[model samples]
Target: MSEVVETTDCTNGTTTTYDVVVEDARIVTPNEVVRGSVAVDDGRIVAVETGEFDADGDTHIDADGRVLMPGLIDLHGDDIEQHLYPRSNAAVDPPMALASADRANISSGITTKFHAIAFEDNPEKDRSPELAMDLVESIRSNDSLLADHRIHARCEITDAPCIDAVEEVLVNDAASLVSVMSHVPGKGQFRNIEKFREYYENDANLSVEEADELIEERISLTEAELSTRIDRIVTAARDSGVVVASHDDETPVEVERLDDRGIDISEYPITLDAAQRARDLGMFTAMGAPNLVRGGSQWGNLATEEAIEEDVADALLADYHPPSLLAAPFVDTGETLSTRVARVTKNPADAVGLTDRGRVKEGARADLILVDPEPTPVVEHALVDGEPVYKAEAPR
Candidate 1:
């Protein structure tokens, strides 16, 4: 339990007060870890001291050397879809699923989440055009939540018909980020056509013939039509100040074309050459935190560790797993803890044009988490905008 407290400085005949103070923490900075305490007031960090705060804070905690780091900013996570459709064919109310998604993310120390919703032409519950529209509207309207929620509308260029819905979301301010994706039989993440068939059949619950026919539909999409659709998306996004990203850049040429189209973020570059090209072209390259945590890519593409080692990976997202985002900073990538933390924090914030709330410095937003790294870096406490949002309860 925490209570408000005040202390008097008799020498100066004055009192110093802070809204919150966390002491004895191994604070993570951008370059180095410092053993110190942090003071917060009015939703911002006001001071960081080498030792304990000389003045008392109203709400105080003894961190006991736990790791205090900035709250994670996840640019791509579809974990909410997991809650929205908990079962294979069952559906839950959007509000209930949203509440579940909020708790899961806050507990995992993700403060800024760009919830990914696919506006593709699909039949699945979560990715269907109907569901995506509903979700974007639902998430944009819902107000009560612990973590920050924004929409990342994923548009499949192969399905040119959905451009209307994509543009609608952009025009209506439902989605702030748009990703251009193409999952044709022999391109992007589905380049391994056989694996694509298997995965597609499983996800859509289709037989071999049905899946192949669907792939044929994607393959039949004319390049000119797809190019026109991409232009429409890029132009709308640019006019609306929405960030646009390229998905699964598999080659240097692919990276170049997207860069020329003004796509600034490369999400999940499948090869080292592509990731390197994105970096050279000044685009932020994002890989999945799950890939880094699990030591390899699920699709056997460019390994997350390999990208990190090559200094081409600038940010990490949760991809399909929220918990992996919290664990990614602890992975050993031959970088200092501070730099590793940057993969999820400062770098991500910068990638999205957010100039604040990603580092432990004075004048930064007090979006922070205390992690007990004994077992696997569990979040013990989380503060968003200087307010306690989550605290782990332990058995007495």
Candidate 2:
């Protein structure tokens, strides 16, 4: 946990004046939104009210009715390491990747993120096990990285060569979440052979001959062997006290099995049946916020907005896009913006067991964003742990 800052001076007999007073801001908490003033003493929220506030200190900001809420938490976004370093054959500077990704998250209002690094030892893809390890090492050593970056090891269960590498990540890095993804042929995400073929062919830039050979080579794991491997990984993860998530669960059976095995989060459940089952089993149904903002899934998975409207989905990941997290509320869900905003803020924090920082309340960490909302949604200011990390350039 980070230290909270404190100050002296208060309005209405409050104990101290806030370090900064965001006056007349549209404050959105989990319960409600208020047209009021927020008092920040040190780096904690000391006062939040709907009425007028007397001047306590010199520092103040006028939000002009833009939405003010907790910073968005991205549960599973691959925008950083994977997208930035697409080729295992090529090496990009790790510090550049970290700094660039942090700025990208700040622009998206994602103050906290679990940078998804897929565990793969393939020589063809640029993402070698060694490179992945280096990426984690580089980010963990740097304290000046913009967002509160955490790790999410997207462990590919079929990658036997990378099992030790996954274990290394768990032991060495701050892996907040571990997701089990099985991409073997005729199972998991590649359940349909044609669809699977299309994905590998079009997405991976693999020739038809190469794709066929790769599919044939994936036959090393028998069904029983695959099941055993998954169990071993899940057991190791649970023993380490890491949050475990099941990826792309496609059916009620899949949900039930994962739920029985103590999986706490379901990432992108492929069907309504699986999503609903996860919700009923007290597991969070993590959908892509991009799906909500885009009005549907990009590749035809379950739409997040529909799941939210139906009360089946509990949280949203930025998935591949960081900007979608902040843009999700403005997607016109017919409900008030306050209500829609909770899906990205309060719901996700709760889903991931982060209780103290999600709402604008007394004593909560001042993880906040000021949105400039006339021409576009611009993040005018951002704070993490009560310190201003991002402030927009003043107009000339």
Candidate 3:
């Protein structure tokens, strides 16, 4: 499947070349999966041809007849926060948490991840604007990160003080995506008031009465300043060439409103009607992969499988779990493998304006993952920009 080809190094007057050629694998492209070999030179895919490559250099990954697909692009994931706070009161160092998340992501086949950091004022814990800014800076400055780290700032519409913080990231070009969200009990992710109360009590340590009062307060505050703040945040993000999303859209009217405001994506629409409306309005509808894997929503919203069946869901996010992205694609979605894979790969990449590295093609950045798609889907190796960042020691 692989052969050695020598070339002269003129400067040293000797034969030397170390290009990598991955051969004898089924490479999944944007169009179709073909049995081929891919040649990489300087972190770019130079060739994708049938059968084996007659030339090779330093490394030749045989792939052992596994599936070689483009590395996943997670649009919205909060797994970093989970690593940052493994327990309710336990907190780890930001860099250490981020490093741990990076290993998990790459091993799960995610080569590019947008770490969803919320810039909000919450009574529960320390998701302060200052912390968000610091985390963003940490992610941006950490060159040792294996995955391509980026920020997705979830701006709480009712948190008026967070506007300046969100704006700072956009103006400074630190955020790749921004989503406007409202967590009032009667709307968004808390459509079921009981679920909202449960989360408030458990996560925020609020009593029943206190949770009710905070919900009412949030509703009033959101109603008073939603329009103006939404406009300001959306305008700033768009001006910075960052993609904007509407989070937890609950109805068709809400989708229409966000569509009018030039939202590029609708994240986790709570109902089938909302998801359909989002697609009809030409906005990409993203549902959590965990919903599909768990067979339903944890907070009692529309099931992702139902949304996929209705052909309304266009993209999938890791949401709170990074491994869900790898597992969700293998579920029986009544679609081709390429189509299901695109929900995590090309769809999210295109929605977030990443024009390269989502598909296996000539001239694209060689961000790829090799998987064993059998009894259980497993990520065998993860490569970012033609370099192997994670490789499984055994079948997993």
Model number with the top lDDT: 1
Candidate 1 lDDT: 0.87
TM match of model 1 to true structure? 0.96
TM for candidate 3 is 0.93
lDDT of 2 by residue, 1-396 (tens): 333334444434545535777878888877777898887766788888787876453356777776788888888988875545756445568888788889989878888888888787555555567777777887789898777888888887778866777776777645777888877667656777777778777766678998887788776678687667667767777667788888998888878887877788899887788888888888887888888877897667788877887788777788888888887777777877667777777777776677777778888888888876555566877878776778884473
lDDT of model 2, residue 12:
45
Model 3 Cα displacement at 175 (Å)?
0.3
What's model 3's overall lDDT?
0.86
User: Candidate 1's residue-wise lDDT over 1-396, tens digit each?
Assistant: 245567888878887777888999999987789999998887899998877567678777788889999999999999988899898678898889988999999888899989888877767434677788888878888988898899999998877667888998888877878998988888878888997798878886878998888888988888778778888999989888988998999999988988988998999999999999999999999999999999899888999999999999999999889899999989877789999999898998887788788999999999999998767878888989888889994543
Candidate order, lDDT descending: 1, 3, 2
Model 1: ten consecutive residues of lowest lDDT: 121-130
Task: Check candidate 2 and list the clashing pairs.
Answer: 9-16, 9-17, 18-40, 19-40, 87-126, 88-126
Error of 3 at 318 (Å): 0.4
Looking at model 1, the pairs that clash are none
| lDDT, each prediction | 0.87, 0.77, 0.86
